[model samples]
Structures are given as C-alpha cells and as structure tokens.
Target: MTPVSLWNRSFVLWLVGSAQSRFAAALASIALSFLVLHQTGRAGQMAVTLACALIPNLVMPLAGAWVDRIGLKRPLIGANVVRGLLQLTVGGLALLGQQTGQDVPLWVINGAAFLTGLSSSVASPAAGAALPALVAPADLPRANGMMGSLAETMGLLGTFSGGFLVAAFSPAVAILLDGLSFLLMATLLLGVTLPNRPEGQPTSSSLWQDLRAGLRLMRRSWVLTVMPPLVLLVNAAIGPVLVVTPKLMETLGVGPRGYGLFLAMEGAGMLLIGVLFASLGSRLPLRACTLLGFLLSGVAQACMWLWPTYVPLLAASLVFGLGIGLINTPLGTLLQQGVPAAYLGRVFAVLSAVGAVGMPLTLLLVSPLVDRWPLSLWFGLNAVGLALGGAVWGALMRIEPHIPALAEERSIEQPQPRR
Candidate 1:
C-alpha cells in the first residue's frame, strides 16, 4: 500500500488545534499558580488548587466509556467549549476582584479548576481515539512525534508568555487568553473529519459493559497488560526527582537561574529527540527505541546520584529528557498500533489515569522524608526502578508475540468477563 502523506488536512488541523490548546494550558498553569499564590498568600492553597485539577483523572474511565459509546467529535467539541467557558468565568471573576480591590474567592477558583480539568479528562481520550482515524497506522509514529515536538515548543513559549503577560498586564489577562485559545481550538476541530461508526449499528452494550470489555481485552494482551504498570513505575520514579530537585539545587548553591537552566537542558534534549523521531519515522524500531530510552534514563539518573555536581547534573538531566522522549513516542505508537480502534478510548484513559496516580502517590509518600534523607537516595532509587522496569518490559515484549492479536478480542456486542 502507498503511504499517506503525514501532512493531510485532517492531521494538520488536529495538530495546530492541539498545539494551540496546549500552549494556552501551559500559560494558564503559570498564571493560575501565581494568581492563587498572590491571593491566598499560602503555598498550601496553591497546592490544593493544583490537586483540584488532577482530581478529574480519577473519573477518566467513565469519561472514556462515554467517548466510546457516543463517538469522538461531540466529546472533543463539548469539552473544549465547557473548558473555555470555565476559564473565562474564572478570568472574569479575577478581573472583577481586581477592579473592586477585593480578592476572588479561593473556592471559586478551585471549583473552576476542577470543572475545567474534568472537561479536559473527557477530551483527552476522545482526542487519542480520533488519531487512528486521522492518520494511517504506518504514519502514527511520525505524526505523534511531530505533535509532541510542537506541543513542547508551544508549552515552553506559553510559559515564557505567561510570565510576560502577568508582568505586563495581569494574571487575569493571561487566563482570558487561555480561554480564547480553547474556543479557537474548538472551532478548528470542527473542520476536521473523523471516521464515523457504521450507520444504524448502535452500541448494544451499556457503558459499564464496554468499560469491562476494554479491561478484559487489556488483560488478554501482554503488551497492554504491561504498559499501564510500567508507565506507573516510570512516573513514580520520576516524581521524587522533580520534588527534590529544588532542594538539591539550593544545597549545591546553583540558585534559581541554575535550576532553570537544568530544566532547559532537559527540554532541549527532548525536543532534539522528538525532531529525530519525526524525521526518521518508522525507520526506528519501536521496541528497541523504547528499551534504549529506559536504559538511558536509568544511566542518567545514576550519573546524577554518583556525581551530584553542576555540570554533571545538567548533563544527566539532558540524557534523562532524551530517554523520556524516546519512551513516550514509541509507547504511544505501540498502543495506537496494537489496540483495535474500537477500544482505544478506554485503554488510553486507563493508562492516563494510572500515570496520573503514580506521581502524586509517590510524592505523598516521599515528601515528608525528603528533608531527613540524603537526596542521592531518591536518585539511586529512581535509577534502579527505571533499569528494572526496562528489563521487565523487554521480557514482556518477548512474550507478546506468543499471545493472540488484540484485534481478535471481541467487540462490545460480545463482552467477556475478565479472567
């Protein structure tokens, strides 16, 4: 079969819309963080607001099932519209408070955050599910890489824009921009076409049944069964690194500027790898690339633990970023290729939820002990986990070929109980 162009109209629209939305989200993230801090004057409240945003991931399974039942376009459009409205409301409230010399209610901000997050949770699976329909399977890796690279670039720009906007105008203005961006994203998505479910073939199974079927299918496939937990492990290991980095930098006397550079190095590495993937496409083997990512991440983390100096730490961070880029693109392609399109929403939702839970849970357990323990301990632990996880993943992939194809899994009409 002839390869389809990666820059087809549907994908280009999706790419631009997604990049703009992500840019807005990154801008809003900074604005929201500073806004809460300025108003509440407490870091605790800021944490609470961020936690509110994450709470919706817990409900992603339900959202995913809904996406599967009703189809993708409506969810994508509706979620963006709702999120746009919510952001605008929050921005309006902040502006009102600014004009009146009063503080916007913390509750209102948190409530808006929660609702917007819920909308995003619904939209995410729908978007992922729609991708297979938008591009040929052979082009998925390049498409995903392009999307990742552009989103990263946009996010970095958005972060800088957020600072500038807040400094030049106000957090309220930046937030309003975010709101408008979402509305624009929704408008753009309206023009993109997706494959529709067959005419007159309505879903026979209840949403709960469909969810169960998704789970059953996952259990039967070695690749699917291993993916969620592996993602969880990687996230869990990485979480403490983020949490402890500031303190470690302080101890090294690098200050905030050095910390920023450290992060920039990582981002630079990821962007470089993303571009490589986009350019090379399927020339790279997914399984080998993923395993190499894990190994690089583990080795990088070990370097951080062993050296703990300014230059070495920066170098390690760059390698870690490259590892992450390698892991994310291939794993995403693996899922898009391995799973039948019918169950894509549910599977992606489950993985997203699992990954979401990992970081917070690990942070909760690790935070209290951070000041008491040596920082190298966290780095060492992360290194070990990544290395072992990679080994286990490689073993699982060996067994994956023996298992029957996930496409053989029954449709929602013929649901099977989990073994």
Candidate 2:
C-alpha cells in the first residue's frame, strides 16, 4: 500500500476542526467550574454540575449504535451544532442574570452540562469512527498520535486562556467563546467529505440489536474482552494518584509551584511521546508498544513508591505520561485496523462508556482510603498490578493467536477504501 500523505485535504480539515473543538471543550470546563462555584458559593455544586455531565455516559452505547446506523458525518456535524447552541444558552442565561442582578440557577447550568455531554457521546464515537475513512489504515498510529498531541496542547492553552478570560471578563464571556468555537468546528466540517455507508449493509435492525452485535464482537475477541479491564486498572491508578498529588507535594514542602511543575512534566512527556509516535510509530509492532507502555507505567509508579522526593516524583510523572501515550496511540490503531468498519462506532462507544463508568467508581472507591492508608502502598499495589497486567497480556497473546490474526484477516477480507 502506498503511504497516504498526512496533509491530505479531508484529514487536515478534520484535524483543524477537532483541535479547535477540543480547545473549546477544555476552556468550557474551567469556565463552567468557576461559574458554578461563583454563583452557588459552594464547591459541592460544582461537583454536582460535573456529575451531570457524566450522567450522559450511561447512554453512550445507544448513541454509538445510532451513529453506526446513520453514518458519521452528519452525526458529527449535528453534535457540534447542538453543543454550540447549548453553550450559547448557558452564556445567554448568565449574561441575563448579570443584567437582572440575579444568579443563574444551578439546575439550569447542570441541565445544559448534561445535554452538552449527551451531544459529545455521539460526537466522540463518530469522530473516532471517521478517522479510518479520512486516512489510510497504515497511517492510523500517526494520525491518532497527532490528534493526541493536538488535544494535549489545546487543553493546556485553553486552560490558561480560560483562567485569563474568566478573571479579566467573566465566565460567561469565556463560555460564549467556547460556543463560537463549536460553531466554527461545525462550519469547517461542512467542507470535508466522508464516505457514504457501504451498499448492502444492514440498517433496519433495532438499536438494541446493533448494540448486542457490537457486544458479541467484543466477547468473541480475547483482546477486546481483556483490554478494557487492563485499561480500567490503569485509569483507576491514575485518578487516585492525581487526587493525592497535592498532599504529596505539601509533604515535600514543594508548594503549588512544584505541583505545577509536576503536571507540566507529565504533559511535556506525553507531548514528546506523541511526537515520536507521529514520526515513527508505523514501524513499531502494536503489541510490543502496548506492553512496553504498561511496563514503563509500572516502573514509573514503583519509582514514585520508592523515592518520595520532588525531583524523582516529577521524573516518574513524565515517564507515566509517556507510558500513557504509548498505550493509547497503538491501541487505537489496533482497533481501527481490526474492527469491521460497520461496527467501529459502536465498539468505540462501548469502550468509551466503560472508561466513563470505571473512572468515577474507582475514584469513589479509592478516595476515602487515601486519608487513612499510606500513599506509597497505593503506588506499590498499582505498580505490581500494571506490570503484571502487561505480562498477563503478553501471555494471553502467546496463547491466543487470534489477536494479530483477526487484524490481518480484517485487512484482507475488507480492504479499507483508498482516500
């Protein structure tokens, strides 16, 4: 297969649009948090508003099935338009409240958050499922890597800008800007062309049946079945580590500056690895990349457990971020290469829903224990679990030849369209 240029028209349009949308999302997140706290004068209300956003994840499977049945482009475009309108509504309400000398109601904000999230549930899977159509299969790793880097860069920039905008103007202004970003993304997407659904593909099946078929595919594949739990474990570990990092920084007498450095190092590491993947990831074996990621993450966690000092912890954070990039980028490629195009949206949705379900549950379970238990113990346990998880995955691959074979079979059986 001839390698496709990464700068191809469709991909460039998608990439630019995605980057701006991600930036808007990050900005909106910070603005929303500040807005809720300012209006309600309570941190708990902020948490509740955040939870409202998460509530839509419960219906992600349905959203995914719907995307698969209809196709990607329209759903992607519609989601952005809807989210933009929702954000505009919130901003308008906030502006009205300011003029009227009354606070925007907490429930209204929360409701908008829920609706925005629901729109994203559709957008997320549609976007992921659209990539294979926009770029060649061999370019998936690089494509995904570029997207990851864009997200991280935009997120960092957006967070900083959001803080400035909220402070200098108002959260309402930042939120209105976010709404504009979404509308811009939708406009850009209108210029890109996506493939129509393949002729003869079944679409009359009920959503439940489509969802069930997606699930059945997951169950049939060993890699699909086990990978989610492995990812969940990693997510579980990362969340608690974030929650406790502030206390850890305090213990080291490093203050907020050091805490910021710690985060910056992690983001820098992720960004570096993303660049590397974009440049050279196509030559690498997916399984080896994934295993190395897990191992590196485990080692980084162990370093955190062994050396409680500020410098070492920062180094560990960097390594952990690199591991995360390694794990996610290749895994995304593996799925895109292996899954049937017809089912891609649903599969991505199921995986996303799993992450959504796992994160809060893990945080809830681990948060209470943090105050009482030694943090090092938590790190040690995660280190062992992550390392063992990698080894176990390797063992599973050795015994189950179907993993690589499945991908090869899919490539041969249903060749991707040449863009």
Candidate 3:
C-alpha cells in the first residue's frame, strides 16, 4: 500500500489510542500536582517543581532537531517508554514507604517531573509535524479539530478523574495508573511507521542556528506570526488563575471541594466549547477565529476580575474555553497545511520554546503577588493581561493587510505558495 493509504489507517488507530492514553496521563498529572501541594502545604515548592517540569519546553528547539534526526516514531516511542519508567519509579518509591508516613523525597519527585516534561518536549511537536502524512490537505482542519476536541475532552475527564482518584485511592495509585498509560501509549506509538523527510535541507550544527531559522519564520512568515503569540498570551494568564483560585477560596472560607467544583465548572465551559469548535471549526476562517478567541478570552478574564463570584467566574471560564477552542482547533491544520513536512518539527519546537518563556515568567510573577494581593485584584490583573493580548492580535490583523481569518484557506487553494 502507498504511504498515504497506510497513514490513513494509522491516523484512525493513533487518534483513538492517543486520546485514551492521554486521558489517563492527564488525570495522573493533575492528581500528582495536587498531591504534592496538599501533602506538603508548600505551593511555591510545587511551583518550583512544575518550573522544572516546564524547563524542557524552553529547551525544546534542540530536542525537536534531535528527534528529526531519528525517525519521529522512534523518539515518540522512546520518550513514552522513559516517561512510563519514571512514573513507575516514583510510584514504587512511594509504595515501599507507605507504612512509614514518609513519601518520596522532594528532589526525586522533581526529577520524575522533569523527565515527564522532557518526554512531552520531544513527543508533542513530532506528533504535530507528522500529521501532514495522515490525511489530505482538505481534511486537515477536520482532523485537527478532532485532535483538539479529543484532547480537551480527555483533559477535562482526566483532571476530574485525577481529583477523584486522589480523593479515593491515593496519589501513588494515581501515579501508577499514569505510568501504565504511558506504557500503553508507547506500545501504540511503536505500531506507527513514520516516513523519512526528503533530503537536502539545512544541516544546522548548533541548536541556536535551528532556533534562528525558526525565529525568522515567526517574524517573516504569514501564518506563524500571529498564531504563536496569540497562544502565548492566553497561556501566560493561566498560571495566575490556577494560583489565585485556591487562595480566593481559602480567604473566602471555602474548602478544597468548593475550589474543585469551581475549576471543574471552568473546565466544563471549555469542554462544551471544544465540542462546538470541533463541530464547526472547519467552517470558520482560521485567522479571524484565532484573533477573536484571544479577544473573547481576554474579555472573560476581565469580567471574572470584575466579579470574583461563582456566576461571573463560571461565565468567564466558559468564555475562556470558547475562545481557546476556536484558536486551538485550526492551529495544527494551519501548520500541517502551510509548513513543508521536513521543517515542521523544528519550527514547531522553536515556536513552543519562544511561547513557553512568557508562561514561566507569568507563573513566577503570579506566585509572589498572590500572597500580598486580594484574590480579586490578582485575578483582575490576569484578565487585563488577557485583554491586552487580544488587542495585540487585533492590531496584527489590521497591519498585516493580507493576513485574514481564512488566509490559510485561500493560500492552500491558490496552487501557488505564498513565498
């Protein structure tokens, strides 16, 4: 069979298996993070732990280049295997010490977190870059919509289930489940046979060289110019909200269950919107939808700050999700449609690296401010930040002149590459 037809079948298998595996890991991740904070009562320490987790994202440019050198399937399978082992190790350490009331040491836990983060740095971009081979150009958005929607759904379900597992079985069990899921995901990845990129591209020696190429794409290219930053700004504000919610509840005299309900409600809004986007995303103009999503999310954040009560907060969360779904659904389709398959992974990594910088700083800044500011005020700033991000994208649309909501659609159909 031709690679195209083989990939058609593989795509279906990967989608189903990937979603199922992701569901488990997502639940485990949240459960593990929650366990750390709850058991240690040290939120900052957990933030630092997660900081180590995010560290790989900043360095992913090099990682992506490395993966391209190996086949995409190998890196994916290897990363999953390593991740599964790391999770199992952590779970085992905790298991052996169950009777002593002593848990895994902080450094050990952080190391495991680091490994999981690193695996993601390798796997995510490769999977994204690999999608062009999966289906034809016309089906790209539909495939990407399915991918994004399933991810959102899995994320919501995992988080809720993670919270439940933490409440029911223990964080160790949650971690073990996470490990097994990764193992299963790895097995599935092994089944996929990726194509080798056509040769005679730049043999960039330094990671910095590859990074510069990516930076140039972001600066000069039409599609990436708007997409990544649109994500970054929305991504940046997320950290503060996560921090502020618990603090708000604590100050408001509510318990953890109340906080979970609030978060789940917030997630629920996104869940509904994700389904909506999956259904209608292909019909929307890509650029406009992205720009508007950021704007709406900004408005939602600001509105939440205006009233930190249950109703407004929930409304804001729903709006945030709606905006996110619109922007995120078509993104992979844009890349798969726009970028040459060979260069896609490196470009994805660099964009991710650049975009991740904002989130860590946002997290760092939010952590210090939360202790001093009123929860209402802290969240209000995040809302303002989201709004400003929206404005920037709106301005980009006006200035670029040629770039529009359905620019990708027009570009793909024209038969002439923009460059």
Candidate 4:
C-alpha cells in the first residue's frame, strides 16, 4: 500500500469529525474542571469531579472486550452518542440552575462527569480498533503519528480555547458547544465507511480468559509490554507533579493563568513533536530515541523545581512536552504495527488501564509530601522517577536485544500471514 494512499475523501471526512469530537471532549474534560471550580469555588469538589473521569479507566479493559466483540463502528458510535447526551444533560442542568437561582450541587455535576468518563472509556477501544482499518499496514506509522498529533493538538486547543470561550461567553455556552460537537460527530460517523469489522458477535467469555489473553499477548511483545511500563513509570512521577503543580505555582505567586500557560506550553511541545513524527518519512531508530527522550524527560522534571522564575518554569514545561512527544510517537507506532489486529483493542485497553494506575497512587503520596515536605523533595522524587523509567526501559532493551522493532532502522513486520 502507498505510504499515504488512504488519505482519501473518506479519511478526511473521518478526520474532521474525529477532530471536532476530540476538541469537544477536551473542552469538557480538561477545561471543564476549571469551570466547575469557578462556579462552585471548591477545590476539593473539582478534584472529585476529575477523579470520576479517571476512576473508570480501571473498568475500560472489559469495555475493550465489548468493543472488539461489537466491532469498531458500533462501539465508536454508541460511545459518541452517550457522551453527547451526557454533555447536553449537563449543559441543560447548568442552565437550569442558573435560571432557578439555585446552585448545581457538586454531586450532581460529578454524576454527569462520571457518565462523560464512562463514554470516553467505551470510545477509546473503538478508536484503537478503527485506525488500522482506516489505513494500510505501510501507513501505520504515519497514521499513528497523525493520530497522536491530532489528539495532542485538539487537547491543547480545546484546553486553551475553553478558557477563552468561558471568559467571552460563560460555562453554559462552553458546555453547549461541547454537547453540539459530539452530536454532530456522532451523526457524521454514519458516513465513515469503516474498512472492516470484527469477525463475530461481541464476545463475553470468562473474565479470567479475556484478561489472560490480553496479558499473554502483551507480555509476548516488547512494544506492548515494556514500552507501556516505560512510559507509565515516568507518569508515576508525573501524576504528582500534575496534582501539585497548580498548587505550587499558586504558592509561588505564578497564579492560575500562569499555571494554565505552563500546561499549554507542554502540550504545544507535544503537538510540534507529533507533526515531526508524522512527516519525517523515514524510520527513526526507536530504541535510541526512546532512551534519549526518557532521559531528557527525567532531566527536565528535575529542573522544573529549580526554575525559580516563572519564565524558566515555562521553558521547563516546553522541554517536558517535547520529550514526551519524542518518546510516545515511536512507542505508539510500534504498538499499532506490532500488535495483532484481533487483539488491538484489548491490548491497548490493558495498557491504558494499568498505565493509569500509577498516577493516583503517586497522587496519594504527593498530597502528604507537598503539605509537609519541601518542594525540592517532591521534585527530587520526580527526578528519581524519570531515571527509573529510563533505566528500566534501557534494561529491557538489553535483555530483549532482538525485540523486532528495536533494530536501529525501521523494518515493519507485516501482519502475520494468514493462518
């Protein structure tokens, strides 16, 4: 297949729909928390709302099994529909509260947040399953790179744009925008013409069997197994930084807007790196780049605390963003190309599910430390996380020296020949 022949009319239409959906999702999920806080003026409630979105990740693998069984389009469409309705409900409630001159209870908004998260969980597996069908094996790298870039780009824009929209209009308008975007995307999905479907009924077998199958496949492939952990290991530290960052920034008088700016810069860095990956048109030495990127990330995390001035903090965020971009693109490219199509949804689900476990666990420690310990101590601990991720992934490379994708030059193994 041509490296990019799949870039036809249908694919472009899908991209437009997917981009808008993602933009809307980002606006609601990433930026919506700030809106909730603005309305309620309660930080703890905001955290709980965010946690509702995160907690569903643990159940998403099972959702993946359902996704694979149902095939990509059904689950994708179903999830979008659910999310659209949920957003519309939330927006209407926010409006209702405003009209009645009564506050929307934190519990009420959080309940909406839970449904939003559940729909996102259901949609994730379908998205993974859809990409391979959308493009040929030859174009997997380009396709995945574009995907990564678009996700990060939409996230950055929606996040930054949410603030502007809310400031210009109001949270009600912002959320209504989100609801309409999802509704539109779901409608457009009717025309997508996905390239394939799962072979049979969406399966519901023994839980142990599904979990075992997913794990077995993951363990057998370095790209599936080692790389995710390498990435997750870094995020173990990142979760804390994310949790404490705004607080720290506030303490240092950088203010909330500055904090948002720091996040935006980090996202921009990821977006830039993603574009480079999409268009590079050559095989990157995955192992070398992964190692260097991980190390750079560790170094950047360590330096973030040292940057006393707000300007330096912005620079540090940029480095963190760029490093993340460099590491993740190749890793995702390998996963998409290496994992079997039949198992792709489950494999990615497993990765997302387990990988997310680190963040909350790290959060448990971050709250206590920041409250009692020095900021330097927290930053130092994060640095240790980076070194550990770099060290562990490096060790895995040495041990699994022949891991197919690790060879310096790119050589994509074709999907296993027909049985």
Question: TM-score for every candidate vs. truth?
Answer: 0.83, 0.79, 0.85, 0.84
Model 4 lDDT tens row, 20-90: 87677656644465556566554444545666666677787888776665577777778888878877877
Off by over 4 Å in 2: 1-5, 34-47, 92-104, 163-170, 198-200, 236-264, 298-316, 362-392, 401-419
Clashing pairs in 4: 69-202
lDDT per residue for candidate 2 within 1-419, as digits (tens), equals 11277678888898898888767766676567667756654444544565567568768888988888888889988999999999999998887887897888888898998898899899988887888888777788888889888876775567556656666667788788789989999999888877556222344458987787777666667788777676666655565565456456656875434555565566666777778878886787777878888888889999999987888998998898788777878888888888877788888998877767655565556645766677666677778878877887788667654544233223333333221
Counted clashes in each candidate structure: 0, 0, 1, 1
Candidate with top TM-score is 3
Candidate numbers, best TM-score first, in rank order: 3, 4, 1, 2
| Per-residue lDDT over 1-419 for candidate 3, one digit per residue giving the tens place of the 0 to 100 score | 12445236678767876787767776666566666766676555656676667777877888877665554787788888988899889887776756677877988988888888888899877877776666666667766767766766776777667666666667787788778888888887666656654242355677566555555544555556765775677567676666556546555654344454555665565566556655775676776876777777767777877888876776677787777665666565666666655567777787676677666677766565656666777566777776776677677666664433222211333343333
Q: What residue pairs clash in candidate 2, if any at all? A: none
Among all windows of 10 consecutive residues in model 4, the one with the lowest summed lDDT is 405-414
lDDT scores in order:
0.78, 0.74, 0.67, 0.67
- Predicted structure with the largest lDDT when compared to the true one: 1
lDDT of 4 at 30: 40
lDDT winner between candidates 1 and 2: 1
lDDT of 4 at 202: 28
Query: Using lDDT as the measure, what is the rank order of every candidate, best first?
Result: 1, 2, 4, 3
* Cα deviation of 57, candidate 3, in Å: 1.7
Candidate 2 lDDT trough over 10 residues, lowest sum: 405-414
**Regions more than 4 Å wrong, model 3:** 1-7, 198-201, 204-208, 226-232, 246-263, 401-419
